[model samples]
Target: MTTQTKVSICLPTCNRPDLIVECIESCLAQTHTNIEILIGDDSKDDRTQRMIATRYQHEPRIRYVRNTPSLGQARNVSSLFNRASGGRILLIHDDDYLAVDGVERLVSLWQRHPDLDVAFANQYEVDQAGHVDREASDRLNADFYRTKSAEGLQQPPGRTGLIQMFPNNGWMANADLVRRISYKEQYGMCCDYVFGVELCLAAKQVYYLNEYVSFYRKTDVSISMTTKRSTSAASVSAYAFIEKLRLDRPLEPARKLALRRIVPIVVSVYSRNHDPIKGLRIAAKNLFAYNYGFSMRLYYHLMMISRSMLTLKPR
Candidate 1:
């Protein structure tokens, strides 16, 4: 008998007892039977534990581990990756959920393309009330499909194309690949983006499926939303990663140009957060060492100065 490929669905959750059950149920209802739902709960309260024990404890496929003290977001996710024992790994955040046959479809695709290292499908962006934002969903789908139709699936999307066709929550990859390219803990808010980029760069072939595999909840309390409200950590992380890529990796001219364009936008995020000093420092570093052209240097300098002036007192 042929051994079936086992998939480990790793869910790193916090204090979202209200939404976690739904996420868990969605995983449990997958059409693929050879799957394990590994939930690493970093919740401050025991609500998640209680809910899992009461509702899903009888299920043999569910394995729930509650960290004694919270492990922060990145570490918790890393822990899940470490604990996963299957041939394939799929990460589903506590607030997000898989479509009924999401895993089955992903597995089917993987079976067809045995050499693929990573696969991602389009996802629905839903509001706090779980209503799909059709406009945003349509736009995302169109962009993804257009890229796939133009590029074709046989060729792996290089760094530049991968950046343009950003993979959201509905991503899956070979288990060994994820273990080898573990999440970088230093990139707090931008870890996912960093992880995805690294995966795409390393993968021999990355596939994009047209199916809507998951629903990503866009709540005001989400990490990205909250980080945007308070600080420029995400931008800082992006800048750091971009610099790392520029310094470490040999990029084609197109990818190099894309990085040059992206640097200023990240700097602008810092400037908007009233962090002109850090932004200027980033701009200066990239300007002098990273070979960012005169236009970008001038733009960052002007933008920082304008932001500084705007924030100045009337006195």
Candidate 2:
């Protein structure tokens, strides 16, 4: 690729007029000039569109699209990719903003390592007040740092590392590759995880840059935070997708072990949405089939009991 390779920051927004400006400004502030900020606005009101029109209308690198009646979240985000004209794509949420030179650093890394199919970096989770929650951020990303090699490069822990630490908003990839493995519209909450796994499995080489790429705002209103109440169909679909990968892919022993460790977490979520009986049945099937560790089996057993107790009706 040439030095002038364009990078598209595909941001999908809906009723986030308060935060969308900062996101757009961050994309505009990138040191790399060869970039475009594609905003697919799904806001019910005209606030976001008006703001963009009034403030960023003259900016040549920003392309704004307003949905007539709102396309919801998944389709709205997927549409941004359809309109993107860059060689590389970074799908960022409207509430999340880059670290000023984040795009420049990512582009530079890709330029140095031209063979990389996808590149991701660590992120700082900030609050609604824009304060970095260092404690929470560190806790969330501790695994990646712990697994870092002596060469400063973080190796995938196992075959399923990509699925486990799929950078939801802190990653960039070749536009062509992303387009080929597009996000599934049916997946409501776990689309990014599913897409991330697909990219990792298909990629020739996935790189992890040490730089902090973006600030992911952890607000109560975010999809992840809101979806914790009930197990979303999307979450169930994502778990099933991973299970299919485990069965179909000729994974190494380490990878299968890593996957086994992740199954209980999915089962817990499934239990919260459905019932403990269903969760236990699925858990038992996997535990017996995979011959999971004693600790994992114990954890699942406890989870089933806890869920059952929680669902008990008042006499």
Candidate 3:
């Protein structure tokens, strides 16, 4: 069937020139031919630019733009959104790619349901050396997306609710949605969480496909997993931003009640890669003092107990 819905895959990349070629190649191989692959490169190195231009230069659909000065991660992603031309924009990270026929499936479902404001399916987690990990799917721990329809609304405009939409930051939404909201600069690590909340709150309908469409390569080098002393500040800032967003919105009594149930889980997420005591300290100093209420207090007290129990559990 002929379709007019154009999809733009915006890939924002940096230093990894070697991995990017495969990433672009995967997009080029999509069965859905109506795709414009926009590459926003932040690398100052001419070699990376030369490599992208040389390999995909012949492909008319490929548009490569190199930033004169690196805009860093979050802004570069936001920049790519501004430059995107397709009706649908997929904010693909540098190290990720669509599975074969992945774009086709997304396009097909989107075409079938034009009313959906957003759509995201499952994605695979590949290892650093590029070996596909069959087990990463298990870690997701829920059929949250599969059971849901292609279009619907998400509730509670904050981190807890946003994670349910696209767990790995892989999905396609209307380009207009991208323009409607900008990533919260304050939350460096969790900007997507804030953005997702904004999108879900605005969207009348959202979609979730059970099938896995993209491969998220998990490596020590990837930004999210890496822990350094310098990044702790940024991580703490993200948590504070999330706390503020959660508290700012006027929510119903029931949803707020549900949020109370989930605070300890949120605390543990922040502590997984860092010291538990330090993460709790950040939570207490920032979220507790500024945003504490029914849920925050419940979470703080629960986190204290959970942290101790966690220490006792065998790894």
Candidate 4:
């Protein structure tokens, strides 16, 4: 914690030694000189360890730790969170790479507003061959509400996160804030989402820069692509309670509007998993909570629920 700015790039990687090279290279290529790349490797084999040792052993800026017994994704991230040393920390997935100036840009954002607790920018979507998709990247930002209009300090930052703007990629936070909120296994796939909310809640000033700071790769091996994630009823209930207890009274309407947009997707995912009962349960809970009238959105959800019930796979 010197007067000089130093950023710790906490990267949690597993089994993808070949893919991680680009990520590491990008980190090393950063314009910011004061950075430590902490690589927490959870690979089953020693390939990643050998690769890092062979390429970066002499490098003072990099630290490599291979977990004796694999830490999985959540625990591995928790380990990185605890070991981070810089004033600010950026969490990078193994398959993703930062812009050459990513850390510098993010740090500069904080330097301008020294009291800012968390800062992040939009990201570009890249393919397996590292080709950036302009349209997909723009749509990604738009969908997440990372538009120019939404730039600047977001009050009650939890609402911005609750609405899905705070992503797992391309963000940096104060070391204390990141360490204060450890990863939770109970949230399942939604743990990252919940973590974002917790970080924003802990932060006094959270700013969204309208610039693209990193590349989010869309690979076949990605968690979202390789697996089907079902949002549990427990997760829905927990999110609802979080909104009720933590969100401001004026933000109630905003939360409801956000939930109105998200409920259909949650219900559809449950339906796809052939768990119509759970889907209906969530749908009914929301409908009853708001005493919703028969609007088109309500009708559409009702129809989706009705179709799912008829087509339910037997237990």
Question: Which candidate gets the maximum TM-score versus the true structure?
Answer: 4
lDDT of 3: 0.66
Clashing pairs for model 4 are: none
List TM-scores for all candidates, in order.
Answer: 0.84, 0.85, 0.75, 0.88
Q: Candidate 2 local accuracy as lDDT?
A: 0.73
Q: Write the per-residue lDDT of candidate 1 for residues 1-315, one digit (tens) a residue.
A: 112889999999999999988898899899888899999999899998999899886899999999998888778888998999999899999999999989887777776777888877778888877899978886866754434454325354456233545464567889998888877888888888778777777778877776678898888887787676335456557656666564224445435555565566666676777767766776666663246455755565666757775896666
Regions of model 3 farther than 4 Å from truth: 141-161, 228-235, 246-315
lDDT, candidate 3, 1-315, per-residue tens:
514778888888888897888888888898878888888888878877998777777889888888888887778788888888888888777788788787777767665667767767777778766777766664552433333343333333232244444554668788998778857665676677667767766765666677778887876776656643333433444445445554444643423333333344455555654456654665455443334745655465556646655775466
What TM-score number comes out for model 4?
Answer: 0.88
**Candidate 2 per-residue lDDT over residues 1-315, each given as its tens digit:** 444888988999988999988888888888777888889988888999889889987999888899998887768877888888999999889999998888877777776777877777778889897799878876766654422441222344223343456577757888988888877876777787777777777777677766577998888887777775466744566666666664334545534554565556666765666467667766777773346546655575666657676887767
Ranking by lDDT: 4, 1, 2, 3
For model 4, the local distance difference test gives 0.80
Task: Report the C-alpha displacement of residue 190, candidate 3, in angstroms.
Answer: 1.8
In model 2, pairs of residues that clash are: none
Collision pairs in model 1: none
Query: lDDT per residue, candidate 4, 1-315, as tens digits?
Result: 222788889999988998899999999999888999999999999999999999988999899999989977778888888988898899898899999998888888766788999998999999998899999999999988899999998877777766678878679999988988977776665567778877876788999999999999988766654544455543454355454556667667657756766666666667667677777777777773334645565576567667878886577
- Output the worst ten-in-a-row residue range by lDDT, candidate 2: 150-159
Sort order, TM-score high to low:
4, 2, 1, 3
